[model samples]
Target: MIKGAITGLGKMGISHAAILGAHPEVEMVAVCDASSLVLNAFNKFSSVKTYTDFEKMVESEKPEFVVIATPTKYHYPMVKYALERGVHVFCEKPFTLTASQGEELTELANQKGLVNQVGFHNHFIGTFRELKRLLSQNVLGEVFHFSGESYGPVVTKEKGGTWRSNPEEGGGCLYDYASHVINLIQEIIGRPEKIDGALLKSFYSKGVEDAVYSLLRLDNGLSGTLLVNWSDETYRKMSTSLTVQGKNGKIICDATEVKIYLKKAVPSEKLEKGWTIKYITDLALPVGFYLRGEEYSAQIDYFVDCISNGRKSEYNTFEQAAYTDKVIEMIVNHSKTN
Candidate 1:
């Protein structure tokens, strides 16, 4: 079994710990957080050694792997500490606040020959895997345009002051939420060549962008757009839809479902049709289709498998994380200017 420790017992940390504990191939060895209240809450249910200092936990438990679910600002230092100890790492998304930090960490992990995985749970979903297979098979031929949106309300303290509301803490809808969309886009279409973005701070704390929209041009000549907001009154919604046009057919994958429209001619008897719109039912995602927890569990399983079997993990690598950071930097810079 792969012995593991988790730091930062906030929502994400607790979730990772639970998933790891449930996995048959993993043994949860320790849990840590700077907050005594959080540590005490976790200790009530878990017998794992709890500590306020992450390095102390690592020194005592000597777990083979560590999960860094701390806030964005602390990610760099914590990950560096773990890597220097020769421990494998599984870090949350937006791995570091900047591209440079991500690149350095990636280099360090490579030099140490350590297994490093970043949490981008959507990549592990069955729906996304199917989409990848279809793309590989040219089902989404000559992909022309793609768009994604992830919008929800601010998850901050009721008193309105929280780390999530501070730009220095890497807080913003674009960085906190859109990282998932950006990561998924990287998976589907590779990195963008140039990006232009606009950010808006409406209905949230001052100086923090609660909404963002970006346009990206890919090297493949394809264009993409992303809309992420924390002020959307609509129910929590995350959707990524791509439209691809080819000589043979057009393919569309919206949310969790897929559709292919062939361009073959119809019978002469039915040739009187003029641009008939067929609502493709196969492209509709079923209710309660995408389960977030299932994706999280799959990611944990893949991380454990990579550590135990010496297999390559499809989880986000350090290079990918760095690229993501660069994209984020561009977005933030553009937001400030325009």
Candidate 2:
């Protein structure tokens, strides 16, 4: 079995623990967190060793791979430490605070030939995956425009301060929410070459933005608008969707379904000339374990499989995530200038 450890016992961290624990080829060895209350429960209920210090847990357990689910502020140092020790890593999203930090870690991981993956779980979602496939086949030929959007109740009302309210600590809707959509756009469509305009608006938070609006141009010259708002009370939870229009047709995709409108029928794909819908049930692949979503478990399984097979994954690599970081930087800079 591949020995693994985890740092941070927050929502994402605990979720990772449950999924990795249930993985047939993975053995949970240790966990590190700053919460004594959480650690005390683990001590009583689980056999895995626990520690408050991440480096200490890594040194003592010597796990082959470690899941870094801590906040974005801790990512650079933690990922650097793990890669230096020749251990594989699976880290949560918004890879790093700056593009430079992400670039450094990407280079280090590549030099060490270690398996590394970021938690951009949307890529594992069935609907989005189908969207990527159809685009690859040029089903929507000569794309002209696109839009990526996400809305959630992360900060609906003004509240007391927390890590999320601090920009230095990777707080803000841009990092926490928009990063997901930006990564999706960069991967599914093309890398954005410039930020035409941007606006970071603050609604409830005093120090950070609750919404983001931007116009971006891709390397392929495809222009698009990004609209994200975390303070929208209408959304019980986060919802992200994408729409692309091309000469041949258009595609609208979200977590649950993908709707296509083709100007002409393609017998090869069995798609009709009009609207056709594909649900997640038909596209999602079965996994050994299920958690918040199959995408979560699917991402973990993909990382573990890459390590065991001595190969690198093309999806959600540190390099791809760094490009996402660069785009975020562009938006921030552009917003300030505007």
Candidate 3:
């Protein structure tokens, strides 16, 4: 069995720990968190060794892989700690506070020949996979432009000086919320070559931005734009959707479904071609202990598979996350300058 440890006991961290503990091929060797309460709570359900110090646990547990689910600022050091000790790492997104640190960790992961992943799990959802498949089949036929929106109620009121509202610690909706949508944008159209009319606005947060807007020119000929608003109370929950329009068809996606409409129907027997649709229900993927979706288990399964084979992930790699960071920086810089 592959040995693994998890650090941090936040919502996402707890979810990861549960999935790790349940994984048939993995032994949840240890867990680390700064809080005694967190440790005690986790220990109640798990008999795994627990430590308040991350390096202490790393030394004793000697985990084959480590999942870093702490806040954005802690990502670089924790990932560095695991990589330096020759451990594969799966880290939550916004890879680092800055593009430079992202580049450094990505390089270190590569040099160590370690499997590295960032927690951009939306792509693992089956609806997106179907959309990507259709895109590859030339269903879109020379895609011309795309636009996306990531909206939520995260910062609608006073945050009371949390790390997420502080810019220095990678706090803000840009990193915590927009990163997922930006990663999706890159997956659809690749990295943006130019950012135009960029705007980052702060609402309830101290100095951090709660909303972002910008137009983009991709490295390819495709054009794109994004609007990420986390302070909007209108959103009941988090919603991220992208609409890709092309010569022959258009693909639109929200959290759980993809809708495609073809101007000229493809000569396929299965698809109606006018508006073929796919839903999360269509995948019928098995869910584990988590209520979020199967994406977490799917991602974890993929990570363990990569570790077993001594390989890397094609999606959500450190390099790809770093690219997303670079784009984020561009937006930040643009917002600052203009």
lDDT of 3 by residue, 1-338 (tens): 99999998889998999888888899999999988999997679669988999999999989999999988889999999999999999999878989889999999999989999998988778877777777778877889889988998887786677777788888888888888988888886567878887888887888888898888888886777888999988989988898899998788987688888988877752566588777888853565545477888888888999999977679799999999999899988888898
Leading candidate by TM-score:
2
Q: In angstroms, give how far residue 156 of model 2 lies from its true place.
A: 0.7
Q: Estimate each model's TM-score.
A: 0.86, 0.99, 0.96
Error of 3 at 93 (Å): 0.9
In candidate 1, which residue pairs get closer than 3 Å at backbone N, Cα or C atoms, i.e. clash?
none
Rank the candidate models, highest lDDT first. Answer: 2, 3, 1
Q: What tens digits encode model 1's per-residue C-alpha lDDT throughout 218-276?
A: 66777778777766656455554554455546555545555556564334323222232
Give residue 34's lDDT in candidate 2 (0 to 100).
93
Go through the candidates in order and give each one's C-alpha lDDT. 0.74, 0.95, 0.86
lDDT of 2 at 45: 99
Top of the candidates by lDDT: 2
Question: Ten residues in a row with the worst lDDT in model 3?
Answer: 283-292
Worst-scoring 10-residue span by lDDT in model 1: 269-278
Q: Who is ahead in lDDT, 1 or 2?
A: 2
Sort by TM-score, best first.
2, 3, 1
